[model samples]
Target chain A: MKLKCPTCGREYDEPVQRCECGEPVEFKLFEGEPYIAKTVWERFYDFWPVEPAMELSLGEGDTPLVKSRIGRELGVRLYLKNETANPTWSFKDRGTFLAVSYAVKAGYGAVGTVSTGNMAASVAAYAARAGLKAKILVSESASDEKLKAVGVYGADVIRVKGDYGRLYFESLKLGEKLGVYFINSDNPFRVEGYKGIAFEIAEEITPDYVLIPTSSGGLFRGIAKGFIELRESGLIEEIPTLVAVQAEGCSPICRAFSEGKERIGRFENPKTIAKAIANPYPPSGNAVLKLLREFGWKCLSVSDEEILEAQRKLAGEGIFVQPASATGVAALEKLVEGGGIEEGAKIVSILTGSGLKTLATAGQGNARECPLEGLENCVSF
Target chain B: MKLKCPTCGREYDEPVQRCECGEPVEFKLFEGEPYIAKTVWERFYDFWPVEPAMELSLGEGDTPLVKSRIGRELGVRLYLKNETANPTWSFKDRGTFLAVSYAVKAGYGAVGTVSTGNMAASVAAYAARAGLKAKILVSESASDEKLKAVGVYGADVIRVKGDYGRLYFESLKLGEKLGVYFINSDNPFRVEGYKGIAFEIAEEITPDYVLIPTSSGGLFRGIAKGFIELRESGLIEEIPTLVAVQAEGCSPICRAFSEGKERIGRFENPKTIAKAIANPYPPSGNAVLKLLREFGWKCLSVSDEEILEAQRKLAGEGIFVQPASATGVAALEKLVEGGGIEEGAKIVSILTGSGLKTLATAGQGNARECPLEGLENCVSF
Candidate 1:
C-alpha cells in the first residue's frame, strides 16, 4: 500500500506510521465502487490497506446516524453519528480493529498503544480478540478506575513515569524493537480504519458539513481522507466542509490555524473536562493544519461551559456522550450563531465516545428523594 | 392490540401491563413474513403490537451475533448475541424504545420505570428522545454514581425509600393515575420489543439452543415468544431450546423450576456480583417457569465465582461484559461438563450489558509502572 505524508508530501511504499520529517503519513486516495455487504469494511472493500480480520471484529463500525431534534432549534438539519454504540463504546474501535488486523497479518505477536482512555481499552480488547499480547502504556497520572476497563481485557498496562508526550514516540521505538505493533493515535492503518465513519455517514445522507471532535488530529485527518476517497471514487459529487472541533483548554491546531501559523506549538498546562480530547501537543497537528488551510476547512474551539451545556443538550435528546464528544455540537452552535453555516443546511456531528467512561465529569441528574408512603405526592410533580 | 396472560390464559382487548391475576401479560402470536427493511423494527414490522416510532429511535436492537472461540473448548458451537451494543449499552433499550413509542402514541406526557440500573437508564434515554418526562424510581440503595448514567438523560430520578419490590407495582399504579406510563420490567410492550433480539438472531443463525441470563424473566419470555411466533409463521421449522440462566445468589425462577413448583417464592437476602440479575422475586418468574415446563427447557443457576470467571473468559475474547451478562457463558460450561447439551450443538449466549457500567466490581487490571526513559526494558517481556 502506498502511503504519503500530507505535510511533507513524502511517499513511502511500505507501511510507515510517520514520515522522515516527523509527520503522520496516510494512505493515498483509494478509488472504487461500493459493494453490497453487511459491514462497512466489506461495503468499502477496496479502501482498506489490509484485509480486516472479520472474525476478530467486535461490530465496531456502522453506528447509528440518529436524526436530532436539536437541529430544528438551531435552524439546521442535524444528525448524530452515535459512535458510542461501538463495541468498546468509542470510535477508537474502528481504528483499533483495522490496525490490529494489520498487526496480526504482519506477524506481530503483540500490539501496543499509548493511551489511558478509549484507545488503550480498544487496543487491549482487539489484541485479546486476535490472541496477541498488548502492552498498554499510560501516563503516570492515569487513574486506576479508568484503567480498570483496559485491564479487564487482560492487557499488560504500564504506567510510564515520565513526560507523556515523549512516551508516545518512545513506545513506538520500543514496540518496533520488541516486535510489538504500536497502533497509536494517527497510526497509518488506524487512520485508514476511521474512513469507515465517513463511508457510513455518506451511505445515509450527503451533508453540507461534518463536525469532528479533534484531539491528536487522527480522527479529523481520517474522516477527511475518507470523504476525499469517496469523491475520487465517484461515490459523492461534492465534499462536505469539514470542521475540526477542540476544547478551548487544549486547542493547538485551532490556535495555529487561526494565527495563520504552519506549525503548531504545544499548549502548556492543558486542562479540561473533555480529557479524551485534551492533547497539548498533537502528533498530527501539522498534517491537520495543512489539510485545513489547503481545503479552506474551519477549526473551532469550544469552552468547557459550552461543552457541558452541549453534553446536557445531547442527553436531553437521549444520546449521552463524553464531554469531548459534545465539542462537535458546541462548535455547531457557534457556527450557526455567526451565520458561518447556512440555515437549513444538513450537518453531522461525530460523538466520539460513551459518557459512561467519564461519569465523574458528567454533572449530577438532580435526583430527588421520596419515601414509599409519600409516593403519591412525589408522583404528582 | 390483543394481549394474553401467559400463565392464566386470560385475554385482554386493550393494552395492559399485567393480568388481573397478577401475572405479566404478553401480545398474542403474530403471524407474518419478515420484510426487507433497514431497522429490526421495520424488518419485523408485522411482529410488533404498536407502530414503532421510527423518528424517535436511537438505533436499538439488531445487535451483532458474534461467533466465539470459547465454543471450541466446550465442544459446542457458541455465539454471543451482544445486546451490550444496544443504544444504552444494554438490551433494555429495545424494550424501552418500543414501549415509549406506544406511550407517546397513546398521548402520555410522562413515562416512568422502577429500576436502578440498565432499565432505569434505558427508560430515561427513550423518554428524553420521545419528548416525554421520565420519573425513574430507583431503590434507596442505588448509588448516585450508577444513577449518573440514568440522570444524564434529564430524567427525574427518585430514590424511593421503601421495599424495592413494592415500588415496581406502586409505580405502575401511580403512573396510570397521574397519566405517567410506567414501562417497568415485563411491560407487555417492553417484552414485545425484545422480540427483535430473537428475530435478529434467527436471521444470523438458527441455533440448537439459546442461553438467556434471566432476572425479572421479561427477556426470557420475550425471546420465547419471538421463536414461537417465528415457528408459527412458518419462518423456521423448529423453535430452539431456550435456557434461563441465573446466579445462585438470587434464582427464584430456577429454584421453583427445580422444586417442580407451580409458582416462585421470594429469594431471601439476594446478593451477587451480578447485580443486574439479582431480582429476588422476578415479576415474570411464574411465566418463565411455565415456559420451561411446557418446552422441557433448562433452568440453571451458577455461583458468583463461576460468573466472575466467565466474565474474565469473555474479556479474554475481547468482549468485556457485566457479571450478569457472563452468566450465560458460565452456564454453557456447566451444561457442557454435564453433557446436558450435545456435542457440536449450536449455542447462542446473550451478553446483556456493558462492563463499564459496573466498573466498581469489575476488579483491577494488573498495571505495572515503568519510567519513560526505561520503557524499552518494560515492553521487552
Candidate 2:
C-alpha cells in the first residue's frame, strides 16, 4: 500500500509528512479489489484494503438501511443507515476496528485518540478487543452519557479541563512524541474504514444521495472514497452526491461552502443539542470542502429546532438517535424545500449513535410509572 | 403443522377453546417439527436459523447478536444477544412475527396484544409490516418511553383508563369480538418464535446455561425447545439446564420452583425495576412450573438494586439495555457469588430491550449539556 496525494496523485511511502509534491498525502491501496479471508468479514470486504497481515475482524459491518416511513410523510424517501448496528453501537467502530487492527499489526503497543462520544467508546472497545492499551482524551464537560460509555470500555480516559478545540492537535503531537499510534478521528486508516458505509449503501440499494451528519469530516470523506472505489471497481456506474449535514451552531464546512471559500476559519461560539459533532474546527474541514468543490456537491445546516424535530420523527419511527445523528434527517427537510432532492431520489441519512447514550441534553423521553398494585387501572379485570 | 395435546397427543386444527381431550391443548407438534415457514418466512434464510421456513413472515428472526464487552470485568464472558436488535427493539418481535403471520394467513385483518412494552411494540411493528391493523392495550401508567416506542409503529394504542391487569384479558375478549387476532404474549406460536433465541445461542456457542429474564414463560419455553430440538436432531448430545431469572417483585415461577410446587399459584403485588418481566400472573406460569420440575431447572430473582447494577455494568460495556433485560445479569451475579461460574461453562444472557427505548427507568448514563454558549465550559480551546 502507498499514500497518494489527492491533489497531484504523487505517491509516497507514508502520509505522516507533507508529500514530495508539497501537498499532504493521503493513504492509498495496492490497486486491486480487496478480498476477505472469509465472507464473515461482511459487505465492507470490498471497500477496505483487505491486508493479509491485518489481524482483521468480522463483527462490525453491514448495518441495516431501514426505510423511514414516518419521514416520508414529510416528503422524501428517507432511509436511516442504522450504523448503531455496528459492534459498539456506533459507526465509529468501523473506523476504529480497522485503525486499531492496523495499529496493532504495525507493532504499536499503545493507541490513543481525542473524541467526544462515539469515537471514544468505539476506539476503547476495539482497542480492548485487540488487546492493545487504549487512551482517550476528552473535555471534562463532555456528556456524562458519552463519558460513561467510553469508560465502560475500559479505556484510560483523561478529561482535559479546558476547551477541546485545540486538544486535537495537542494529542496528535503528544501521541507522536510518546511513540503511540494516534488513530485521529481523521486518520487515513480510520477514514478508510468509514468507506464501508458507502459500499454497504451501494450493495443494499443505489442511493441517489447520502446525507452524512458531519463532525470531523472523516465519515463524509470515507463515504466519498467508498464510492470512488466502487466506480473504480466497476460496481456502480455513477456516484451519489454526498450531502454533509451539520449543526448551524458549528458548521465550518457549511460556512465555507456557502461563502465559496476554499478554507474555513475555526467556528466560534458553537452551540446546539448535537454536542457529539459540535467541533468548531473540524479536522477534515479542508478535505470535505475539497469534496464538495470536486463533486459540485452542496452542504446544509439545520437549526436546533429542526434537529429536535428530526429526532422526534426518528423516535416516532422506533429509532431513538442522538442529536448529531438527527442532523442528517433535519438537513433533508432543507433539501426538500430547496428542491435539491428530486422527487424520485433515494436518500439515506446516517444515524450515528444510540439515543440511550444522550438523553440529558436531547431531553428525556416521557416516563410514566404506575405501581403494580394499580395494574387494573389501565386494564379490565 | 399440527397442534397436539401434550397429555393425550390429540391434534387440534385451531388453538381456540380446548383440545378434544378437554385439556388446554398446548401447540405441540403431534408429529414432525411444527414448521419454520410459519415464522421467519424468507428473511429466516439470512441469519443462522435452526429450521427456517419457506413462506410466511412479518420479518421476524435474525436479530443481531452484538459482540458487546459489557460486564467483561466481573471475570464474566458476557455476550448480549441484543434482542433489541429487532425492528421493535425487543425479542418479542420473534414471537409476534410468527403469531401475526399466522393471523394474517388465517385472514385476520387486525391484530391485538396486551403488553406493557416489548410485545406491544413487536406486534405493532410486525402488524404494520404485514399491512394489518394493530390494537395494543397497555397500562396507562406503563413507562411513556415504552408506550411511545409501541405507538409509533402506527398501532392503535389503547391505554385502558382502568386496571392494567384487566386490560390483558380485556384486549383478548375485545379482539375476539372484533375478529382481531389477539397475539397473546405466550401464545404457542409466539413461543415458537422465541425458539429462534436458542437457535442464535447455538449458532454462537453451546452455553452452559442460558439465563432468560422470564415473564410469561414463553421466552423460557422457547429457549428450552431450541436446545431440546438440537439434542433430538443429534446435533448436540446434551442439553444445558435453562435458568429462569425473574424480578423479585413478581416471581411466581421462582416461588413455585423454590417451594417445589407442581403448579404455580398467582404471584401478588409484584414490583420491580424489571417491569418487562415483572408479571404477577403470567399466563404460562403453570407450564413454566412444569418445565422446571421435569428438567430439574432452577429459578432465581434479583432486587431492583441488583438489576440497576447489572444495567450499569452492561452500559459500561457498551450495550444499553432495559432493567427487565438486566435482571438475568443481576441473577448471574448471585450465581457467580464466591466467583464460581463453573469453569469453562458458557453462559448466555438474553438482553430483551434497548436501554435507549426505556431511558425513563435506566441509569440515565450521565448526559451533560454543553449549556448553550456554554461550550467553553465543556471544551478546551
lDDT of 1 by residue, B1-381 (tens): 899999999999998999999999999997642222498998889999999988889999878778889989778899999998888999999999999999999999999999989999999999999999999998888888999999999898998998889988898889889999999999999999999889998887778999999999999999999999999999999999999999999999999999999999999999888999999999999999999999999999999999999999999989989999999999987777766677789999999999998999988766899988788888997
Give one digit per residue, the lDDT tens place, for model 1 in A74-138. Answer: 88988999999999999999999999999988999999999999999999999999999999999
Instruction: Please state the error at residue A129 of candidate 2 in Å.
Output: 4.4
Candidate 1 backbone collisions, by pair = none
- Top TM-score model: 1
Q: Which ten residues in a row have the lowest lDDT in candidate 2 chain B?
A: B32-41
iRMS of candidate 2, Å: 7.0
Q: How accurate is candidate 2 locally (lDDT)?
A: 0.72
Could you give candidate 2's per-residue lDDT for residues B1-381 as a string of tens digits? 557777777777766557777887666636622232323334334332333322223234555554445435555555567676554567887787677667876888988787767787677667766667876766666665556556555667665556666766766666666778888878777887787787756765666677899998988988888788878877777888778999988899899889878778888887787877888888888888888888877788899988988877665554667889988788876766635466545668888877655554543334333432333333221
Per-prediction TM-score, please? 0.90, 0.73
Could you tell me how far off, in angstroms, the CA of residue B312 lies in candidate 1 after the best superposition?
Answer: 0.2
